[model samples]
Target: MTRRTPSTSHRRHQRGVSLFGLLFWAIVVGFFGYLAVVVFPTVNEYFTIKRAVDKIAAEAPATVPEVRAAFERQRAIEYSISSIGSNDLEITKENDRLVIGFAYEKEIPIVGPVYLLLKYEGRSGQ
Candidate 1:
């Protein structure tokens, strides 16, 4: 009986990623990182606005005008809020409880001539 040796071709093949594959992955990661950097502030601002609205809702104002005034006061104290105003709010009452609703859009520059538009909506109750 004769025994055959292992083929050299099997050993000659290389494994793992190539230089081009590495570069492509690097670019993909970089793009996501950039997107996060551009998007985080807008999300943060949305939360801040939500908090302010919640605070006003908790106050349970008796009138719509009072709600607007309270929001304006909060906005004045919060320098981060520039995209919203008293007129932007939708005020209503349910079960003798004040409900405030607001919606706004924020445009963030991702790159030259490229922008990301984020839509934010908030309600005081629930």
Candidate 2:
């Protein structure tokens, strides 16, 4: 058997890994980073709205109209709060205070479906 020497060009070609691999991992990290920074906050807002709604009837004045008005105020607050960021959220009265809910739409990082929806509801205490 004859001993063969490796060419310098071959060594250079095999050095490290492909740039494509690095790029692929970069994209994945970017996506997850976006989820952590952006998506998580929107999700938090959904729960926040839910928590706020759950307390509305208890915290609001003891009247149907008062509850309704409080929900409307919540809607306004949702819009105002979301406007400060990339997350776009909306609140609508479904049926009295028993079915009030919120929906959100966001432009996800490198993802489609530019909208996300979330709902919450509560009933008046008798």
Candidate 3:
């Protein structure tokens, strides 16, 4: 009977890593990457909305009727974004500032029904 060397025994015991391990991690990273792709745009849009709201606020009309008209214009822009699909934008006036809110839908590649909403507030120019 021949005895096996320590190195041979170690090599035999140390089996190569399974493809499944690599595949599993790949799946995880792919999922996160997909999520980042989907979510990042919405986040960027939220920031954009914030900046736009500030600009609108800075330029809003001073009178009540004009303020209402300003709101209507804001609504028109919001509805346009909503028409595309899972995104909605809305603006409201509170006290002396206008509050802008965004509703973002998270539909996965095919179409999953998860939604998220983000809001921002800013003051209108007098």
Candidate 4:
């Protein structure tokens, strides 16, 4: 049996990505990263609002107005909330428990004249 050495062509066929390919992937990753940075805050804010509402629901207020007032108080203390208000809530009663529901939209500007509208909804009872 004869043993043959590997050809130079085989060695020349290098592995891994090219500079351009690397740059392209970097840009793609960077874009999604920036998108996450922009979008995450909105989602986080929605969750914060949801948590506050849940707290109010857990307290089990006596009436719809009282529910709104409780939320208003929470919002006053929690400076992170700016998009929601008492009027925005959908108050109802279920199983003799106060349920506070709300739906709102957040407009996030990604670039010039381009915005992302995030719609968020939650119920305090759930």
Candidate 5:
């Protein structure tokens, strides 16, 4: 029968995460997860707004008011686009093509006195 004791070299060469290291990584991952959970909805809304704008632009509304109204109607339907109002849309005609653009800021609170500010802007495809 042979009994083997852990050598100093083996102990020093051990590679693994300590409890503290694991905890630190867990906290970091958890924090990013929390941020993603908080930010995803706003990002979804941004995409929704972009889609609505693209649709409106493609439809080629006659007037700026018409574009704005179309966006309002879309907002009423989507319910996710609450960050910007119809008036916030920038309507312009580039080469006689209706281009709708918008920009808005979203503030997300992560913790006490800590907030994340996201600026979103997009223009409809011609």
Candidate 6:
């Protein structure tokens, strides 16, 4: 009868994640997932506002007041534009082209006293 001893090379070849390592990776993935869930709505709102600005700019009302009023009307129609009002829009005329610009900051709470600040800025054009 022959008895074989366990080889150190065989033990080294067998590898898998430990419980602590698994939990660490899980927490990392979960944290990013949570961040994405929190930040998605604000990103959606920014795009919506950008669309509204581009639409208003393409129309290009006669005067600055008219442009502001037009944005107000658009905002009333789109309920997601609560962050910035008509007064917040920067209306400019450059080289016979009417430009609509908007900038705003949004703070998303991740934890107690920890917030993610997002600054969104955009102008109407191609």
Candidate maximizing lDDT? 5
Question: Each prediction's Cα lDDT score?
Answer: 0.88, 0.52, 0.53, 0.87, 0.91, 0.90
Candidate 2 Cα deviation (angstroms), residue 121: 7.8
TM-score of each predicted structure versus truth: 0.86, 0.46, 0.51, 0.86, 0.90, 0.91
Candidate 5 segments exceeding 4 Å error = 1-12
By how many angstroms RMSD does model 6 differ from the true structure?
A: 1.8
Candidate 3 lDDT by residue in tens digits, 33-95: 887777676566545445554565677556545544654565466643231221233546777
Q: Which one wins on TM-score?
A: 6
lDDT of 5 by residue, 1-126 (tens): 666577623465669999999999999999999999999999999999999999999899888888888999999999899999998988888888888889999999989999999999999993
Screening candidate 4 with a backbone cut-off below 3 angstroms (N, C-alpha, C), the clashing residue pairs are none
Error of 3 at 89 (Å): 7.9
Residue-wise lDDT of candidate 4 within 3-121, one digit each (tens)? 65685224566799999999999999998999999988788888889999999989988887888899899999888888899889998887877788999998988789999888899
lDDT, model 5, position 111: 90
Clashes of 5: 0
RMSD of 5: 2.6
Question: Which of 2 and 5 is ahead in TM-score?
Answer: 5
> Candidate 6 lDDT, tens digit per residue, 2-102?
56567623454658999999999999999999999998899999999999999989997999899989998989899988899988998888999999999
Best of the two (1, 2) by lDDT: 1
Lowest lDDT 10-residue stretch of candidate 5: 4-13
Residue lDDT tens for model 2, 34-124: 7677667666665656655566744735555665566567767676334222122233344454433444454544456554343332232
In angstroms, give how far residue 80 of model 4 lies from its true place: 0.8
